[model samples]
Every structure is written in structure tokens, then in C-alpha cells.
Target chain A: MAQTFSASELKQIYDFALDLGRRAGRILIEGVEKRTGDVGEREEGGVGGGQREKMNAVDIVTQTDLDVEAFVKGEIERVYPGHKFIGEETYSAGSSKEYLIDASPTWVVDPLDGTVNYTHLFPMFCVSIAFVLNHVPIIGVIYQPLLDTTYSSLVGYGAWQDDGKVGGKRKRLPLVNGPKAVLPREAPKGCIFSCEWGKDRRDTAGGNMWRKVDSFVNMAAEIGGRGGKGGMVHGMRSLGSATLDLAYIAAGSFDIWWEGGCWEWDVAAGIAILREAGGLITTANPPANPETDPIEEVRLGSRLYLAIRPAGDSEGETGRQAQERVVRETWKRVRALDYARPGA
Target chain B: MAQTFSASELKQIYDFALDLGRRAGRILIEGVEKRTGDVGEREEGGVGGGQREKMNAVDIVTQTDLDVEAFVKGEIERVYPGHKFIGEETYSAGSSKEYLIDASPTWVVDPLDGTVNYTHLFPMFCVSIAFVLNHVPIIGVIYQPLLDTTYSSLVGYGAWQDDGKVGGKRKRLPLVNGPKAVLPREAPKGCIFSCEWGKDRRDTAGGNMWRKVDSFVNMAAEIGGRGGKGGMVHGMRSLGSATLDLAYIAAGSFDIWWEGGCWEWDVAAGIAILREAGGLITTANPPANPETDPIEEVRLGSRLYLAIRPAGDSEGETGRQAQERVVRETWKRVRALDYARPGA
Candidate 1:
């Protein structure tokens, strides 16, 4: 019924998938610059919440958002009709929230990575898609249309981009320099760090977010001889786009990025892109396996990821140790808002 | 004796000084593209303890950085040489602590802002220069070399910039789209916000920088519709440079921006630029005039500032109310962070 293929066949499939990502990126870029592609309020259609649930503070959705998901889903279906395809809007619409993620070579698509930035005409958004076989991201493509940059990665093959844009194109996501740049150098002590303003208010049960932000900014001010107190991080930035944020880390454009409260669709494609760019993605708490499966870990929402561009070139073990230190220090700074999460 | 001049004469002086800001910006852009600037690290001359004692950052001190500062200072001196000049490197080299602000019309300059980005070839930094009269930012000039963006503002001149870059041919900073675009909206349940990470940390005594970051990010997350639990403030972002971050708000690129640990050099000129765009800048707590001496109540060394561009351009009465609401809401967020600064 389905056409099965060999290793070469898989390579061809990946190549085609990469082409599709580029094409989609072009379409998105053209759409953004056009006045016609505006998401004006639909006064014509009565306000309906079903089509778009409150994603969070400062975020909204629409049928078009869902339509983009469907478009990508269909594109994958048309190419590899037998290959499993999973996307966000469909999951929200369907009864199964599992995403049906299987090891049997699936394509993960996040049609719109930063919906909030898109709605507001902010330029730090992207379209992310990943192809995986045996639960490893064999091929990944991430495109930020507004910024006109696309990042892609393939298993063992390595990660790269079209050219320098958004977060620079890199062999590894960050392509971080050596000891003078990475190890022995102490990770610059102070620099620009990134993360989104996820939920979990200090007034809530999941107050870890509040604690993290507080410690982060304070640390940023004091760190790195940037003119404040600490030299741990110079600055902390959040661009509202997981795809672009993670891309920044892989490209070595940004030093580090820690995130939580995101779905697989939000980070799946970027994860591969970052890893390919010589970056490491780890957990926020224990700081392990940034590439760990997005399973429901304590919370059912279960989508948290921490990505960093280590200074080491995988040969040296210092980067790993630096990452470990960062996590421990960050945890020490966090003072749990709600004390509900297990780690707290 | 200091040469005495009328208030309008002071305004003329500001005009001439801002002229040099644009010129400095041009040179900076060329320097960046050509990478043709010379970089020199100072010999670690000054010895001051307490905090600046442990400097862990390596700044790219270049001719471009100094040339711009010197040029701006020269222009000011040519018009009124008696006025003092405070710059990033000059301040530390000359004085151990800080220069006197005793009613002197001082020019604070940060030549070649975003040097790290400039060196690494990222394009988000700019040149910031502010004219402080007796403490308040009387006039300011900010320019992003690459973007050809120049913002000039005086206490009463209403602030403006040269649009589309016609070789220093200045024009009133046009309000984007609607006049409201120049104004700060009610931080829609889901809007885009911007901030920066300064050199602050939890380890520093009496400095709640860590808490500030946590609260700020949490506000972005918790402000309503999507990521957080109840509220929505759309999205949050942080571009590395404080001047550019403020300029973004003035250009209606961002709704609100909050920062601390950033020196007056980073934001003094930006504050004028934001206010010129009909925005509000004030202390994060105690809600007072950030333009004057209220900075003392602002938790010394912790430079907390909140700026909100008013939407719907109503400066007479309603505009004041809009400014009040923004300040209040910003205060509310700060309070949230303060409570969470030490961590929840």
C-alpha cells in the first residue's frame, strides 16, 4: 500500500522536505510584507472563542493559524503520503492530544512559530518543521519569513542555513569559538541571555517562572562586567519566538536560552536546528538531555526545554561542565513561586 | 566663569549637538561594514573597589567608540565648552566614582553602542548621547547607524527625528499609522513588550535584579491570554541596547520597556527619544519624575525605569491619564517582581 524505501530513498525524501521548507519560507515572507495578508479583526464574523482559545497573555489564534497548520500537514501528506504527519491546530481540534509522535519517521510542523509576534507585526517569528526517524531528528528546517532567514539540520550530516541572516548560518547552530570564545574563557561571565515570559506568576502555583526571571535579570546586571553586579550574564532577552530564539543560540548569536511552557510544535524543528549548529539542548531543572522526548513529565502540559551553545567543540568536556554549572546556579537563584512543581 | 546663556540658546546648543549625533552614526555604520576600526584594551588603570572592583567583561574599545564620543563632546564644547562631558571610558579613566552633576549642562555619551554586537556583526546597537541639565535629561540624541534612525528631543521641542535619512535633513518624527501608535495602549491582554538584561544579579547585596527579571518575564507571561494563567500583555522582548530598546518604543515598535542597572548613558538619551514620541518615562517604584532627582528613590545602583508610549495621542488631559495608567500598571508589574525578586 505504502512505498517503502532504503537509506538513499530516505536521503532523497529529506532533500525534498528541505526544498518544501524553503518554498514555504518564501511564501511566508511574501505574505508578511504584503498589506493584503493582514489579520484584520473579523467584524463580519461574530467573535468566536472555539476557533481560537486564549493561548496565554498577549497571544491569540485564528482559523488562518489553523489553516496554515493544515496546509503544511497536507504538503507532507502529498509528498510522503505514507509518512506520519503531526501539527498543532489539528491536535487542538482533534481528540488525541498525544501528537501521535512515533519513531516511524514522522514530520512535525509548526506552521507559525511566533503567532503573537506575527499578529503584532514583530519580526522575530518563523515557520518550523522537523522530520524524524527512530525518534531522532533526521532532518529539520526552520524559516523566519519576516527576517528572511532559514535554518536547517540533518542527522549526522550536520546543521546549516541558506546564508547569514536572523541568527547567522552555522555548521553547528552556534559555531561558538574556542577557549578564547568558549572554554577556559568562562563563557564570558556576562552576556545576553534569552527566554520567553511564560506563565507562572509569583501569585500562582507554578511560580518558578517568576523566580527564574527575577534571578536572571539580577544576575544579568551583576554578571559579566557589563556595569552591574554579576558577571554571569550580561543581558537577558526574550523575542517571543522559540524558533528564532533557539536559532540564535545555535548560530552563536546568543549565548544561552532557557524556556518552558511550549509545545513540541513550538520547538521540534528548532531543536534539530540548534543541535546541528553545534549547540546543546538540555532540561531546565536537572539540565540534562535538551533533546529528551516531550512527554508529560509531572505536569500534563509537559513541554519545557533549555538550550545552550557550549563553548567546547564536543571534543573538550568543559562546555558540558559549564552548562552543568549554569543550571545549578540558575536553580539556586530560583525561589519557586508556588512550590507545587516537584523540583520546587 | 561658566558662559551664561538663555534657555532658547540652550535649545540651539542641543540642536547643534544632535547634528553631530547623526554624523557619528554614519561613521559607525561604515566602521561596522568595513571592520576597519582599531580596537585597544585599556591598561586597567583606575582602581575603585566596592563593585566596579571585579570587572569580568572585555569591551571592544575602538577608535569608532572614542571618535564618536570625542566628536560629540567637541561639538558641545565648541558651542559651550564649559559644560562637562561624561562618557563610558572617560568617566572611569578620569574619576574614581562619578562626575559632579551640580547644575551643569552635561553631555552623557555612549559612543558606538552595542560594541559587542558591532564586533560580532550583529545590528541591534546604536549611539546614545543625552544632555542633562542639573540632573533632568533636558535634551537627547540617539542614532542607530545601520538603521539610519536618529531621535532628537528637547524639553519643549516635542522631540523628532530625520525620516528616511536625507543626509541630516531633520523632520518631525512622524507617528506611525494612527496617532495612537505613538501612544501607549493598555498593554492589550496580548501585546508585544520589550526589555533588556542589565549587569545585575542576586549575589549583589541590596540589588534585587534577579527578582526584577523574574517579575518582568512573568508579567509578559502572566499578563493574560496565553502563556501564563490569567492576564495577557501580548508578548515580551529585549533587544540588547537600551537606547535602541527605547527607540523601538518611540517608533511604536514596542508598547512598554522596563530596565534597571543600565546607566544614564544607556537610557538618558533614550528617555528623551521616548518622550519625544509621546511616551512616558519614570521610576519603577515610588512613581516620580524620572527626568529629575526622583532617581534617588529608585533604589540606587538599580536604575529602574518604565516607559510606555501613549496610544490615541491625547496630551492635554487624557494623555496624562494614559501615562498614569501605564505607570500604574508598570508599577503593578514591578510590585509583582519585587515580591518575587527574592524568588517566590
Candidate 2:
């Protein structure tokens, strides 16, 4: 079951994905702008699987989303035949947690990660493409067309970002890049915390939605709450775009992105870039210290994640210690309710 | 005291503010980029009034904020010798609420609205500038240099936006412009809700922090709470930029912006844009209808505002009715705990 591709061959595939992702992102931005004007008259209800147009309060699938998935799938197949595809718009039903069990080269794609934002013309959506080999996200690319920024990473090669405003120079993650580590500040003090309330508002107790609300309250509560342990974060932000959330954390703009109830495609690209940029991704479950846990223990499709940006340059031992202390202290106060479905 | 200026004179002042705002925004952006790199090692404590370096859990004041305010004030004085000014970085202590009572043509400015975000390099800060005559915001402009987008409006002239993308075309607001009005959908049901956890995190009951937590929980709660009314919004967003929040709602991207614990300068510019775009601004307090009440009833300096985007064209009486119904229903379920201090 050993992989047959050489390092050079893997690099070639990574280059292919980076180019294809950028092209698909441009298509998404253009299509979204053209379609935003007509959203006024579009009916609210629909159903979907393959371009199956479905609409709901939390999630919506537009033709553009499906089209982008198909286009990316087609492009990937053209470049590398026999590579399996797992895309959001056409993801198989009842494939939770075990979808990545097949040990083949798979291209995981969330052609439009933030479909809800895309529909609202919120400018927070993105195209997330990742190449997974042996269940590992080896190559990842996330392109945000509105911001004209692209984040990409090849496993072991490190993460990089190309911002349109900076003359499209590909800045290696942490801004300083290389030998310099980029440490994050303590939570709720100087940190910009990111999370989302996914569209799963079941009224039942211990439900995913219920837990998210509880967690948000706890994270935002005052430092010393009335007879409670409040995380007292500096601020809370929900931009409605998960891929960008992970990408931003990787880029050092956001200190942490805690998410749950999302699939593998939603985070694969971001996870790859994050790790490459010297960040760590762990379960959102509270009291779990990111400093001590090996990131390899992080379950890919656990539907929960707590991603922390790298502490600044490796040389500053004190700064790095402070960053880790924040992560530990923040986790001590966080209590994310379990979202695992019954008998999963 | 009736205003002495004619319509033409007011237009001239508005034009000058727009030009000044754009120039000031560029300077802020340049300064921010230059300063973001050094934030890593900058000592995290200081005190502030006029460029008094200060740091706190919620608010951070950098030199750039004070510099930008001074630059804008200087530019305005050179253009009109006697116009009074009230700006965030320079406002007198304890005069936060009553600074706008003067009947003169006063320029209200928040040189940097999202100081915390700016300090964190989060890109949610902006330059908010408004010209108020007789305590009425007659012209407003909000510029986000990071995105290079500008939202501006002159009373009676309507709202407009110039996105740095799309070849910098100055598209009129409401997106539809002129005859058509673009309305927002119902809240917590496909609606994008925006709010902020401002820097008033006093842990005491009935304090700003306590009240914000209560409101957020209520808004995000299930439609039929166990024993209480729930706002049940589609999703919640806290981008930490009040000016951008109001400007985005005025531009029709955000459906609603519910804010409290902010100042007049934070929202005056956005109020002008919202009104000019046919949107409605009312108190964040629930059960108050903007339709029956005069726009003047919107207490600008009250530090509490609830703004809603219009629903499409006015021709469809049924559509307009539906829009109003949503707002009314939303208000009924909203219960923002009062944060005003006793005998203020």
C-alpha cells in the first residue's frame, strides 16, 4: 500500500492544484457578481445532489457551487487520471468519518466553502482545494477572489500567501517566514478569536447548535464572571467563511479558529496551510492543551477543530512560552459541548 | 437658530469631506501596514486622552489613530475656518454622549473605528467621517483602506459606493439605485446579522458587557425558547468594525446591524448612508417601529442603534409589507438589556 509517486511527481501535482484553484476562484467571483443582481427574484426553495439546487436557512447550494465543483473535478481528472474526487456539492450521503478510508490519491474540494456567505454576497466565501494521499492533506490551496488572496501549501515545504495588494508576492506564512516563528498572544486579551454558528439549530439539548451558542457565550463572557470561569477573549469574530478562517489563522491575522460540524473538505486545505505555517490544529473539546498534544492526534473529520497560529520566531523562547501559556489557559476556560451524533 | 448655509454651500462641504476622507484613509492604511510588523514586540500597556498611548482588554489606542484624527481635523479647518469638530481620539472626557449637541456645522469623526482590530492587523477598522448641521448628519463617508472601498452619502442626494474592484465604478447604493429599493430578508432566517462586543466589558450586572452577552444569547437562541422569546437569527457576525458594520448594511450586504456602547461619530456617517439608501435606523431597543416614528426619532448619540436594509423596490406593496413585518417581528423577540448608567 506504499505510495508510488516520487517527490518530484508530488510537487508537480501540487503546482497543478495551485494553478487550477486560482482559475476556479476567478470563475467563482465573476459568476457570483453576475448572479448577485438576480438574487432578488430567485425563489427560496430547491432540492439537490448533482447540481441539485437546494435552499435552507443555514445551507444553500447554487448552480455556481456545483459548476465550480464539476469544473475542478474535470480539471483534476484531466491532469491526473484515476484520482478519486470528494466534493461538497456531490459528497455521498452517509459517508461520515470513513469517507477518507480509501487509500488512494483523493482530491477533496469545497468548491465554495462559505455557500451561505456567497448567496448573501458577503464577500467571505472561497474555493478550497486539497490533494490527499493516504488520508493526509499533502497539497492545499485556498483562493479568496474578493480579497484577491491565495493561500497554498505543500506538506513539508511550508505555507505561503499571495496578496494582490502586495504586488502578488507570495509571502511565506507568519509574514517573517523561515527561521522566524510567529507566536500568538493570549486569548481574549490581544487575540482575535474566530468561530461560526453553523446552520444546525435543533432545539434539543446537547445539539450541535445548542453547544455552539453555549461555547460562544463562554468565550465572550467577562474574565471573572459572576461565580464562573470566563475566557474573556479580546474579541470574537464570525466572518461566515471557514476556509478563510483557517487561512487567516495560518497567515497570522487571526490567533485561533474554533469550528465544529464541518466536513473534511471544509478544513483540509486550511489544515494543510496551517500546519505548514507552524500552527496547530486540535479538537475544540475543552481542557485539551494544544502545547502538549501531538497534532497527529487531531482527527480530520471529527467535525471539531481548534486551530492556533504559530508563536513568533523560534528564537524568542519567552514569547513562545507566553503563546503556549495562552493556548493552555484559554483551553482551561473553554467547554465545547460534544456534537457527536448518537451511535455515530 | 436656522442654518445659514444654502443647499449649494452644503454640497460644497460634502464634496470636501469625501475628498478628505479618501486621502485620510490612504494615510491610515499606509501607517497600519508599516506598524503591523512591529506590534509583536511593542509593550502592551499605556494610557490615553490625546495620543495618550493606552491598552486594555477591549480598546487599544495607537499613535496612528491620534495622528489620523489630527490630520483630518487640520484638513477640515483649512477648508472651513470655524467648523467645530468632535473626533474619537480627541473628544473631551465625560462628553462622549453630549458632544454633538452644538448647533454649528460640526464634523464628527472616528479616525479609526476598530482600533482593537487595527492593532491586531485584523483589517476590520475604517475612517468614519460625517458632517452634521444642527445635530443632523447631513453628509457621511466611510472608507476602508484595506479593501479600498468607500461608502458615502449626502442628505437628499442618496447613498453610493465605489468598490476598488469593478474598475472603481461609483455604483449608487441600494444596489438597484434610483427607483428600486433592495430590502433584507427576515432575521435569523437567511438573514446576516452583525453586532459587536464593544470595549465596555464591565462584568457587573446591567453593565455593557453583561447586556451584550444577554442580547447575543437571545438573538441566537431557538425560535421557541424553553420559556422565553428568541430572536433566532440566520447567523451572527461580530467583525469588530462599527463603521464597516453600518456601511455594509447601508450597502445592502448586511441585513441588520444592532449596536450599543458606541459613540455618535461611530455611527453618524453610516446613519446618513443608511437613510440615503432608503434603509431605516431605530433604537436597538425592541418593539420600536421605524415606520411609524420619524427618522428624527433615531437618537444618533444614544449609543444604541438598530439599522435594517430595505427590501427591494417600493412598487411591490406586498414585498414592502413583508419587509416591515420581519422588522416588527424581529424587534418583538429582541430584548437588549439597558446599559445606560443611572443619572448620566
Candidate 3:
């Protein structure tokens, strides 16, 4: 059983989590540099004897991952003695989707969200931590140690960024760091978007791999679907970090992010931060009939999400209206992908 | 005829260019922030009176790009009055491919290399500068303003990075800031590669856009054309900046980069820096007969480049040999794209 904590109690946990995240980030940064030149294990000789763990050919894991998960779990356990937990490292075999469906007040964590990138010394990975109440992500914190940046928030509170000394400023989310967003209704022509080429390259029919190929072609095609001309958005990028991709959208650095096949841990913390920043997160495909399929039925494990950055009133339409138009337009382009919640 | 100078004279130019890059970077950073929150012009309202120029839906020009180009050109003219120049903003309209064929000592400049990225306020853009002597890049400097990182080198001299305060280090390339390179024979599986979905989405039979789709599928396929099964490499990324992409390869931050359709200005500086770092730059597709084709003939504007980071003898083979093996293997995977030099 999980204990029901008051808002004040949750805030305390949130504060502790942020500090824990920064310390964990330091550990990750140190480990990352060590692995950069250590690619020998897979080839001929490697950096003497570094331990390399692979959950799959493309999905890699490392000692740092296990160490970080242990640290986060230990810290949470020490503070909230009765809380339930779901984490990437401790995830039981064959139960990838089982743990995330419950309505408990559990801590969902992906101590290292972009392991492949981390192994390659790429700088886009993050440590994602979230507190979910009755299946809702209520508190979230994501820290990218290499860049010394953090994105955090509580459900009803706002999201914030502590962008270390180089940037030299603390900021609210939807980062006022750049120009206000310009989202045109014809997405492919006016917006910059992001998606991932996930590791699962099982190319069977209905297997996620072929769908990605089709999406890339359709999105970049000179023409749109079935007889319609394409929206021809500005561009698409695959930066390899799910946590940062979500956080970037939340910060309004990107216009939209559409992805499929990432699990709950990949999105739990980000959903909280994104929502707090006034962004919208929807299933990659819209409800077949808006009146018949309620948006409330969308779940984290649905494995497909289309996120949009919030706009300000300066762009002619209200921010919400702009977000809706972009989403509706984008949804039309992606009608081929089916990401409906497993049973709903 | 163009003036020929001693190595010392080139060094002076290199030092000057580095300083110029820093100054230009400061100007870009200033302009970038001003444009943030200024996207109102396209829709209804916008950031008050700031000029926004769009060469196309995907290519944008800002006052800063023009200002930086003029600043660079003026400073060069003041110091070296007779040098010829080729720049993105001033490329005498309609002759994009005409200027690079000559052998004059010219200053090739891409004042803003990733304009679309800059316009979207994405952080992958850079200021790329190179001094080409008789079609050979002799001095190069690339500065990424937002990150405050500078990558520079003179041909035959080594590549170096002034990583600024955030990194608090000055170092030689392949960034012995970490481990030495470890390249494996199975290119895709061992290396993290990068390319671009460039704005030229022509979809014609011999066009660039459709080839990207074919290459992505072939590279990520479970099996190859030859009898062997597929080589599923770690992953591919599209970071949106051709200049930085090559610079990162020079720094050994990424293992391989295969790209086409970028111009001389886009690659000249990076080519010089990469060569200085002891990396290999080859055409994306191998010659019909490697025994008869000389690698040295690969040019800056051939527009199809396949680059790999050099490795150390500690990794079983020498860096050059490792580069050859990976390139050979990767070349086998990409038979769909035709990037043979136009008259070679």
C-alpha cells in the first residue's frame, strides 16, 4: 500500500528530488567523459576493463545507470519510507508495461533516459524523475548533467530552469530565452519538429520500424497524403534524447515533438513539466471522432505522443487556439500511425 | 594572380580569423536573443520593428547574418586588401555552383551556416570561415556563438578548440579531452553517424531528398544486399548544422558523418579543421574501382562527403586503416545514392 501525502509533504519530496538530481547529474557527467574514448570493448581492445551492458544491440546500459538508479531509489526510500516505485534499472523482466498502469502514488524514474547517446558521449541524455498520484504525474524533475541544466515542476505549480553559470539566469518554462514561437497552421512549412528512430528495428508488418520510414517519407514528401498537398513544415530533427526533447518542447524551443515506442518512464516526468509550462500533450493520432473519443482516455503507455509548445496572444490567435490548430493540422498528416491506448 | 604567403603569414590570418569569429559570435548571440519572442510578424503582431528576412520557408536571413558578413568582409579588406571572397549573402544571385571551380586564393565564408536552425532559435548554427588557396582550404575557423566554442586549424597544423569557460579548457582535436578513438569494422553498429534532410526536397529521380529515405532504410535494414545479414549500427542523428557536424567529427565527438548538397562555404572551414585533426574525408560512395581512384582528388564542393575520426594504434589498427575499413563497410550499405564528383 502507498501512503497519501499532503501537498506540503509532496513539496518536500520535490525539493529533495531536485537536489538529488543535481548530485546525480554530476556523477553522470563524470562517468560520461570516461566512456567517450572507451569504445574498444565492442571492437578490438577497449578502455582496459570498463563494464558494458546491453539490453539489446541498440539499447545499451552501463554501471553508471545501475549506480544512479540505486542512488535515486535509496534517497527516495530514506525519505518516503512507504512509497511504491517503478524505475528503469529495477524493472522486472517481461513486465515492461505492467508497473506503470497502477493508480498508486509511485515514483517513476528513468535515471538515464538516453543511454545509447550517453555511451557514445553524446550530450542529449537526461535523468528523469516523476511522482505520480493515481496514475497522474504530479511532480517532475529532469536534469541534463553535461549541459548543467535542469527542468522541474509540480502539477499545479509552474516549471522552472536553473541554466547554470554560462547562461547566468534562472527562468520559467517556455524559456523566454528566445523569440516567441511562430506556429503556422501548415505545420511542415512553418514549424520545426523532432522525433526519434527508436532502437526497435523489427521490420515486420505493423512492426513500428516500417511506420517510422513511412512517417519520415510522408512528413518530408513533396506532397501530402492521398491527394492533399503536404503541410511541408520547416524540418524534423532526431536529437536522441526523449527527456530533453520533451523538455525542449516544454521550454518552447521546439514547435512540436511526435514519437512512438518510448515507455512511461520516458515520458512521465516530462509530461508534468510540459503541462505546467502550458503546453499540450496528446496522442499522436487524434480521436477518430472527437465527440466519441475523449482526450482524457490517453495514457502514458500508449507509446505515441504529439506534443506542442504553447504560443502567446501576439500570434493573432490565442495561444490555446494556435496550439489546437497546429495539433489538428499535424494530426491529419499522421493519420497512418495508430497509438490508441492499449484497451480504451 | 593571387598572392602566395609563408606558413607564418597563414598563421597570422588564422589568429585574426579566430578573433573575428569570437566577435561575430558575440554579435549573433545578441541578435538571436532579440529575435526570441519576436515571431509575431508572420501571423499578427511581432517583436517591435525588428527586421525578419526569409529567403525561403526553410531558409531565413536576419539583420545579424548580413551584419556579420559585412563585418567579416570589411575587416578582411582592411587587413588583406586583394583577397577574393565567396560568401552566402553575396554569392552573386543564380550561380550557386559556379564560384568554387576556380583556383584563386579566396575567403570562403558562410556567415551563418545553419540559418533555418537560427531562425527557429535552435542552437546548432555556426559562423564558418575558411581561407582557400588555389581551391585548397589553408586556414579554417568555426565558431558556435551560443555555445561559445571555437574550432580552428591551419592545413598541416593540428586542430584545436577553445571550449570557453563552461568547459574551461583549450585542447587539441579528437579531443584527447576523452579517450582516443575506437573505430570498428562494422561501421553502423559501432559508430554514431550524422547527416541532414537538407531543404532541397526535389523528389526527382536523381534528387537528394528521396535518396535520404532510401539510405536510412538501407542503413537501418535488418539485412544487406550482399549475402550477410544487416549491420544495425547504434543510431543516426540529424543535428541541422553542416559546419558543426563536421567540427564535431574533427573533435571526435561523433564517429562518422555522411552528407551531400552542402556548398563549399558550408564545408571549407570544417574540411580544413577535420584534415588537421588527422581525420579522413572521402566521397559518400567509393569509386567504381578503388584501386584506380585516388582519394586525394575528393574536393570541398563535390558536396558528398563521408568523414571518419582517426583512431590510435592502441585500438588494434592504426587510425587511417580503421577509417578505411569503416568507410568500405559503410559504402557497401549505401549503393542507392549517386554522389560521384561531376567530372571526375
lDDT of 1 by residue, B138-166 (tens): 68888766446577777666656553322
For the record, the alpha-carbon RMSD of candidate 2 to the native fold, in angstroms, is: 6.9
lDDT of 1 by residue, A1-344 (tens): 23345777866766776777666656554443231122222212111111112232122235446656777777888877888877766666776545366557678788777776665445566778888666556678887654455677766556665533322322333433322235324433554567666644444444665456554544455444324334476556677787778777765567667666676667777777766655667555532332233322222123656566634523445555665555445444433332222222
Please give the fraction of native interface contacts (Cα pairs under 8 Å between A and B) kept by each candidate.
0.18, 0.21, 0.21
Specify the poorest-scoring 10-residue window by lDDT in model 2 chain A.
A45-54
Poorly placed runs, candidate 1 (over 4 Å):
A1-83, A161-175, A184-192, A205-232, A287-302, A313-344, B1-64, B67-86, B96-108, B114-123, B129-197, B202-236, B287-304, B313-317, B332-344
Give the Cα error of residue A288 in candidate 3, in Å.
3.9
Order the candidates by lDDT, highest first: 3, 2, 1
User: Candidate 1, which CAPRI tier?
Assistant: incorrect
Model 3 lDDT, residue B268, Cα: 91
User: Candidate 2 residues A1-344, lDDT tens each?
Assistant: 94668888888988998888889987787664453332222223111111111223122236678788889999988878889898887774445545453568888999998776666656678999998888778789998777777889988666777667534455556542222233433354556789887766666676776676666666667767634656667778889888889988887678767887777899999988887777778777764554575333456777778887765533345434545565565566556756664322
- TM-score order, best first, reads 2, 3, 1
| Alpha-carbon lDDT, every model | 0.57, 0.70, 0.71
Candidate 3's C-alpha lDDT?
A: 0.71
